[model samples]
Target: MTASTLARRGLGVTVVERSGDTGRTGAALSVPEGLLERITGLRSEQLPRTLAPGVQSWFAVHTALHAAAAADLGIHFRENTRVVEVGQDTDAAWAVTAEGERIHADILVGADGHRSVTRRHVAPDKSDARYAGQVLWIGVAEESAIGSRGWPASVAFQHGAGYTLIGYPLPGADGSTAPGARRLGWALYDSSRDDVLRGSGALVGSVVQHTLTAPEIPEHTFEELARDARRAFSGTWRDAMVDSIRRRAVIGTPVAEYVPDRLVRGRVALVGDAAHVANPMTGRGFAESLLDAESLGAALSSNPGRGDRTRALLHYELDRLDAVREFVRSGR
Candidate 1:
């Protein structure tokens, strides 16, 4: 989507990715209404039919329930493109090589990921990515598993001994088409870095075990942990949300990280989690990434001959720094 947006403005764009295919496997994340409205330029009438039915209400991390309307937009995900190296010359053009194929452009954008190769190649001296002492397990739960609508449809942060569990339903892909189900976001806390490296089920098992074995789970109340799948999800609500998590499914450990200083380097820039990743505890990554793409696209497209593309890049970097910081602080 970012590449297409930038390309429409006559900017040269070649998306280089490491994946051999578009791995559309991860659970859906949030896209804030204000950002969505601005980016897609759609009205309230256009939203309902365009959006998925699972989104019930717009709940904030610190605020009240509100209605959010958004425009219809599609993200064109490209696969099989892996960017291995990025180099900028004196001419201000970037030379990017991926899978032995080289492409030259006046600007580079690394929307790759947290362990961004472009970031490492450009800002080698930057501090290492740190874990936020939490590992998240995410998957879809059947509507049958959830009997009632106990909490808001958004994120619920359940804090316990040495950790926090964040639960939320991912819109649309709740498996409602053939079999009705809802996506569940579980952010469990872990003190050991070693445990996080071991992956999802281990992390979840640790959470279950923690709640069962530990006498006192700090900050986490039994009310948070005591949601019986049959009663709370399936038996109570007319439209119940259930557990979609399959037996022994691995929902990769989500370790939080961020880049506070900048969002780009030379011709290369970053969007999405590659640039600034917030803890899932905040539940704002998808919203922020979509915003970044639109903001960067607007800056690049609107300003022509304004001291080169770097000026726009710098603007994007500066604009997002404070927002990312604020989001991170709130999650903490």
Candidate 2:
């Protein structure tokens, strides 16, 4: 996104990604009205519309849309390339890839993610991301499979003893609203302790874990999740939850937050989760990333040339830091 925004400003930009393909892990995202235009110079109506009041779409669809726009603007992309470290000299900033390739730039933007290598180099002394004592199991269910469950088109939430369930509609695979073409997106939040997860044999590793696909989840765990859903939700919401659990691929991740003491250092600037990571409860992760990219582009475009680039980066950091802090605090 940062690369695309910069490219639109007539700046030469290159994006280095470790994955061979674009990210497809995230499920649905709700985008507030006007955010698309504010961030990407694209109208919200240009994308698929969701049954959920405002704009909502699959995360992959949103990503592909922005990626296409960026490509149209002539931004360069390097896939399957892993960046191990980021370093900057008095003149330029550079990324050292695992393959031992060095890519230099006038200014390096670390939009890597919550576990950003650039962030580690930029602020070695900063605290690491902290777990927020919750894990979210997310999935999508075909509306056709859901049958006549009478699910609401708008977002709905149900709070349980130690968890919460959120449901909303998503555009279909083709980004359409036709019957049997839409999907119901759902997330189940479990706020139990690590001991509970461990006892259930679910916490197999790190603080943050993802299953990627539903079939990969243990049968026992899936059964327990379904039982829990029955207890927490009712009517169509519960039906949607069970349908998604049984029919769709699922992904789970421990909620975590990271707020860096600084967002910029020398010629390097951090954006998105690289600078701050808020819990998904804020419903602002994707939106915040776009905003970060937009802000960086505006800062650089306004203060052109090498002499003012560093200062502009600092200004961008100040411009976004407070809002990020609020998001982190609120999400927790």
Q: Per-residue lDDT tens digits of candidate 1, residues 1-332?
A: 46545654655455555565222323444545544335444455644422433332222210111122111122233346666777776455553455576666677787766667677755667624556655444334444455335524555655444444445554333223332344344434545434434432333322211111122222222223233333333322212212333332224354656645767676667777667766665667767776788788878875667357788887877777678767656766
* Best by the TM-score measure: 2
lDDT of 1 at 258: 69
User: Would you list the C-alpha lDDT of every candidate in the order shown?
Assistant: 0.50, 0.74
TM-score versus the correct structure, for each prediction: 0.67, 0.88
RMSD of 2: 3.1
Query: Cα deviation in Å at residue 293, candidate 1?
Result: 2.0
Model 1: lowest-lDDT 10 consecutive positions: 62-71
Candidate 2: where is the Cα deviation over 4 Å?
23-26, 40-55, 193-216
What overall lDDT, based on C-alpha atoms, would model 1 receive against the true structure? 0.50
Residue 283 error for model 2, in Å?
1.4
lDDT of 2 by residue, 90-130 (tens): 89999999989999999999887777888887788873566
